[model samples]
Target: MNDKMKLKQFFPMLAFASLALAGCGGSVSKTGIELSNLDQKAKPGDNFYQYACGGWIKAHPLTGEYSTYGNFEVLIENNNKQLRDLIEAMAKGQHEAGTLEQKIGDLYNIAMDSVKQNKEGYAPIQADLEAIAAIQDRKEIIAQMAKLGSKGLPGYFGFYIDADIKNSSMNLLQIGQGGLSLGEKEYYLDNDSATVHVRESFKAYMEKMFTLCGSTPEEAKRKMEAVMGIETRIAVPSYSAVQQRDPEANYHKMTYEELKKDYSGIDWDVFFSTMGIQGLKEVSVGQPEPIHEVEKILAETPVEDQKAFMEWKLINSSAPYLSDELRACSFDFYGRVMSGKQQDRPRWKKAVATVEGVLGEGLGEKYVEKYFPAAAKERMVKLVKNLQDALAERIKVQDWMSDETKKVALDKLASFYVKVGYPDKWRDYSGLEIKDDSYWANIVRSNEFDLAYVIDKKLNKPVDRDEWYMTPQTVNAYYNPTTNEICFPAGILQPPFFDMEADDAYNYGAIGVVIGHEMTHGFDDQGRQFDKNGNLTDWWAPGDAERFEARAKVMEDFFSNIEVLPGLKGNGALTLGENLADHGGLMVSYTAFQNAMKEKPLQTEDGFTPEQRFFLAYANLWAGNIRDEEIRVRTKSDPHSLGRWRVDGALPHIDAWYEAFGITEKDSMFVPKEKRVTIW
Candidate 1:
């Protein structure tokens, strides 16, 4: 969906840190840092990330299956094994029809049946393709786009229902620019060699897909050109990723009548009726320029060309579920070309991921019951409280903010909605049916089932603040500004993030920083716009807002200068929010760790002082290897800095880090106090 509310997470998708100290060829301990994991040969003053994580990096090199491999993947692999056992057990048992077990079991069995999938080939989507070919007029074409979009295909534009940005209580219909096969507009428009290579690869993949669907070579070439032309025209006016970050800039709410009159290329009444939405009075057009461009393309394009574009959308979206050949073709461009993943993941992994995606909360309910410990939740509550108290203290003492703003900041801090482990209530999958059918057909039905919920229950309803956006099995944490909440799912509760046996320093540096990072997101450039109640209203004093930006600007310029690759540099403005969260997380969590030590003092363990272990533990959370292609892709799309930079680029600005390592101005990584950012 185009207008999903932003949930600022610690990492991009599948992004998380691990602090498990086991399996590093060191003495096994229930607590403390992993001494063998550190590259003692490297100097901390010059490269702390390398010094702390070098040994781990050398031990765990990137494999063909991953573009990047680190502590997060280690945790993911462990979780997947547990999930596989659970799902496979269900698949092997006999359950009553319409039961949750039956649905999940049948879905997994069908996905794993490669013989059936290969036999079906593209037969499942042939009907949809025929419908596109049968279209005779503009209205028919628009109607077809709506039909495909309902099944999660990219149409000329994207539409969804979400909490209104300005009014956070009620759900509103939102539209934004989409339809580009290459997600980033830069890939289509950039003149760089890397971009051009990817562009060509995407084009080749498109032609191959057309040919696989029984098109002649000549016909496939013509269709590929038609689809590319349509998509390129749409990409021309689409918002850049950075531009889309500004909530106020992206949001343009208009009356239903105004929308129909201004963008009259499509029939609004028909579109809404087709989408099963009624009584729609207002809509938010996020990035209207691209929608206007799409409108022009739709109205002017030839009927045959439009049909080819629609067919391509269906083919591209359905390839993963269709056949092995189609799946490999899809992965060749997206996986091998874009991310440089040398090999495809195992089929069981793909099937497991599909089951999780469609019925996540269902799987999560069982996952929490089996894998998540009750004691972990109890401890997390206390850790969260300690971090909250620390943040409140920092806000109260901030010299850059006035008393008027300080009061509000502390109020926001106190009002934080903390969710640990899992949600109090889980989603019901009673209406979903899993039958013996084609995998692609089942996928479409699952998507429709989800869309029905959004249309039937969520539209025109009050936002459910208690609902969890992520599953219990997800190895991640997030801060949703609209809900003013911080969530730590069950998957991230285990080591090296939260070790019940580890001392305060290890836990504080790992999960403690994560908890504080989500808390600090409330005051980041975007999150700061939302008030205590989660409405997008500016509550800062005049001078305080200016001072916050001025301080943040230093962070922007600091990261912008660091070269992640030979010619590529970090996007300071794009990563400003995450950078601020990282900086603030360290400050708040360190204060909490110190407070923790005051009550129960800790002695040095594993030949490192408590302070040294704290930083080392934090660095270990980011230890792993990454491919250069992934580096380029992430630089263009990901908001979080590279893992190495998360440690290296971030620690330089942290004053406590200097004290922990005894670094002075003479150190290569030292920054003058005048230039360092002090914003929390």
Candidate 2:
């Protein structure tokens, strides 16, 4: 639900690249069955999504956050493995002290270069921290925080939400829920044995951060304990990064003046200066609950502990966003607190993501020009249209859903604005810079710049067509009904999805279905509540809507019955709409392929028929392996079904599965025609 997710994490440009590897589904040597006919069609290499995401599945076997298999996350971990290979090659390279040759070994030549000296390193900060006992005035605390904290205030202790209660009489404050952790809330609060172990590990990490901050072993331990408590207070808030950014859910506006009267200890003037030095003078605090609670807690805290809390806040905020020295020092604390790892992030992991995030689309544009090619993109457009056509046709034929519902559904489909490649307007980063000494400053400036962009846009006319989300280098996609748009970034444009050189069967089976998937989002259960204009409202007749919901209920129960992990309960209500979309996406994508083959006088090109390949391509998209813990996490949080269920669930409704595989009741995926679930 964070802005990043809702923005654009799709694979339009990348999906087209999938076109290049099109129709390459060659036959698989089936178990126990000998293939005497070499001329017979083959099952594609990317058969079951369960298998394709095998490595990722195995790694993220446990689930925690949003439901389904962490499809997007699985890709990220796989990408990290690729990045690790680059790191390995660089580490093992034998070369001269300085040369472009050695540099080519990895992303940066000095990535692991030892510093020539530790001039002005930890000793000064250590001395200053000892002086903290002398300072008690709130203004002095602010000054010390600015000098030491990376974020000034907001950046401290993972995150510091401004529950500024300056204007409200009721005194409710909005607390930001999440910051950096394993992304699971229980990582901090859960008292279960595993959670306890993680907490102890976190405490150990806190000591590591203290060491980085120039504290001695004793001081580091003491400092970390202090820091951990402050962070826990912040963490206990009722929102996550996801919830805070969800405009659909969290749009309650309030005033600063109201916030001040409610939240304690924070002088309204000083607090406003920290958040928006210029803007707050004019506008009141929006929501003030978190600050109100924070104030109450601070009032009850013993005088001896106040300094400790304030100093820790200074360290937390100042550590991450300042200079690399501070960043490194800060991570010493943050890394251990969140992950239990005490080591610094490998330079490549942090910098490459930043570099690629910034320059990905520009570089991707070139990469596509050279390797992915425009032909692939153009061909994908045709397939996208074909999938759209297929959906439109399905709407026309849906028996359970009345014609009234179909009309509205078709309009939503027809209105889908496909955003492929990068945004028309790239984010303006001219104000941001990479300074040699002030990494923290640069980060703060960048954040401020980005925050300004979002805030400024709120006052202006909504830029509906602009891209406010992911760069093309990311490997995911999403459907945003609020904007009535489906975005496909350039990041996912390569591999597995489509291959221009591959046959029509593979291409259609892959990216064509993907296009269908995004298309289905427009008409998903929740999406159906919104009109074509992207405003949420009931657009369908009550009778027709009820029928549609009844059909979707079957899908909901199906997913509800399937346990993604052993004991964790699946949230069928949360995931119902997405399940519906997946089922429909499969149907729409399959039908498109069926139409594509109609004129070809098609025969089985692989050992498996085209229809079989079609479904395989689908399962392949979701293929993965997972850790049991990861599965538990995903089931508790993720909205989509597990990879296995996604494949098995969708197959029964696909009539083509029966025709192509000669599937009968004996086959697990087969459902009698009477029992088949269908709705447009």
Candidate 3:
């Protein structure tokens, strides 16, 4: 692949499992499968995704507020309702000062106070805007960028503290390319008609925002051009999403002195002081080329042009918290133009979402207490263990991997730490101050508080393994390579993903596969680079590593050829790890499900065999209706394949699935025996 086209998608915090399900379950039939979701006319051998999801897709269409709707959205809607109740109840009640509920309630009140918000239009961020306008020199511009960076706003670049890839025991500061109003570099550079249209829309959006900031049309045009020039320059040095996947390649450790000397334009001392860091040592530069590009831009770009870009960045970052007009302008571009949503989500939903983002763990504490049960956690524990056992057995008998590599893989499996339902310790939010006077101010403070918290936790402190990346209320699961752990939040441990009431087949196919998927990640392309302790290491023998890469290459070619939309092909290399996990998860979970069946025999239920029901449950979890625009975007950006491909692409590789459904070479879904790609 061309280096320019090899840009890897960066997950700033942690990587989540690729194969996950959505939502609470609906009415169960005798067969456990929601028969209403099945299209009886479609043959399983020809197109399993359609066979399994056709009816469900027909029943559910994309609403104005959504670009895509599926099991995940249904679950989110249910969870959002629950969150809404909690927020509303808190807003309605009286609580003491400095309490979690008080903060929640107060923020809710401020957000919903449209009259007050309209009266104080743009006042909350007036100080920040004025500060940006005051920047006349290069030093001031650098200082302001650092100030904005601390408040979680992108300036010339972005930074975060993550477990050091090499050490896996200490945290290090990682910096990369940023400052794009458009989310991705491809939006600024791609010559496709859709991409060109997006660039134009972004320019129009910037003009509207500049006008709202009290600029004349001429001034707005100049500012927009300056901003685009700087962003395009920054985008020039950005690595493709594919390049970011190789963690070892991205990790470049350097001292503060070396960095300042090497990239000489910016005053490192002023920037660090503004960020409240007294001393700095080593920092990991993620994409060094981008940083060099930034240095070059800083040296060559005029102070006025730099200020123009900075001003736009500040306004754009604060737009959501500004007046309704500004917020609507933002929505019109990012929402309608980008994702194809025709309308804004309800005000209450937006408010609830803001609160969740700011104080997720606090909200999650309440969520798990009321919703997640002890029995569900207990069941999940057993399910995970079964999957682990199945994977261990498979590793022991692998023909390609040497005995030495197998032993290490088994050790890594044994060392896996599992977190279910919720975290053992909830984050302390007492330091965060929330006031009802201004919603935007409270959000800025929240961002500052979060920034300080992250710095305090990582700078001189040991790595906190107990720290959870996601809140309990998030309906997602992840495997943290650095921590060597898999986390299943309480929000995801619900009916459709995992349910105590559901049959063994359903649970195994849903959450069971999820568990296996996470576990399989430890041995996937990127995860395999890390040892049991989560440090990036080559644990595999030389021959074994080459063989694994060869197999992975097969997967890359297979998915790259798949056309997701007209003239849009899936980026196989970009999605290789995820596709591998899906395949591995299904294989391991099927084995685990069979083992469970042996313990408690399964019979044909509701006219479907046990194996058939299991496969159907897997397919049903991903059934969704999505817009063409969204499909086109995901085909380029999303790491996971589309839901339809997740089913149709993965099932044919599984021997048991074919046997259970009586599929053969004559079927459309069949692949020649020699062509199937299977890597665990």
Cα lDDT for residue 583, model 3?
83
The CA lDDT of each predicted structure is 0.84, 0.51, 0.81
Residue-wise C-alpha lDDT for candidate 3, range 1-680, written one tens digit per residue: 01111112343223443322223555475445788888989999999998989999999988999988888888878888888888899999999999999989888877787787777877777788788888877667788988876776777777677788788888877666666667567888899998999899999999888888888999999999999999998887777667777788888889888888877777888887898776778877788887888888788898888888877877787777767888889899888988898998888987888888788889888888787779878888888899999999878877889999999999999999899878899999999999876877787788889878878888755689998877888888988898899888887887677766678888788888788888888998888988898898899987999988898888888889888878888899888888888888898999999998898878888778899988998998799988887877776667788888888888887888989999998899898878888565
Cα miss at 233, model 2 (Å)? 5.6
Candidate 2 segments whose C-alpha is farther than 4 A from its true place: 1-176, 179-182, 189-191, 215-249, 253-273, 277-350, 358-372, 399-402, 438-441, 456-461, 543-553, 565-574, 640-644, 649-655, 667-678
Off by over 4 Å in 1: 1-28
User: How do the predictions measure up, each by TM-score?
Assistant: 0.96, 0.70, 0.97
TM-score of 2: 0.70
Q: Which is the better candidate, 1 or 2, if ranked by TM-score?
A: 1
**Candidate 3, number of clashes:** 9
Q: What is the number of backbone collisions in each predicted candidate, taken in the order shown?
A: 2, 106, 9
Ranking of candidates on TM-score, top first: 3, 1, 2
Candidate 3 residue 426 Cα shift, in angstroms, is 0.8
Which stretch of 10 consecutive residues in model 3 shows the poorest summed lDDT? 1-10
Candidate 2 lDDT over 299-340, as tens digits, reads 554433545655554455545333467666555433443323
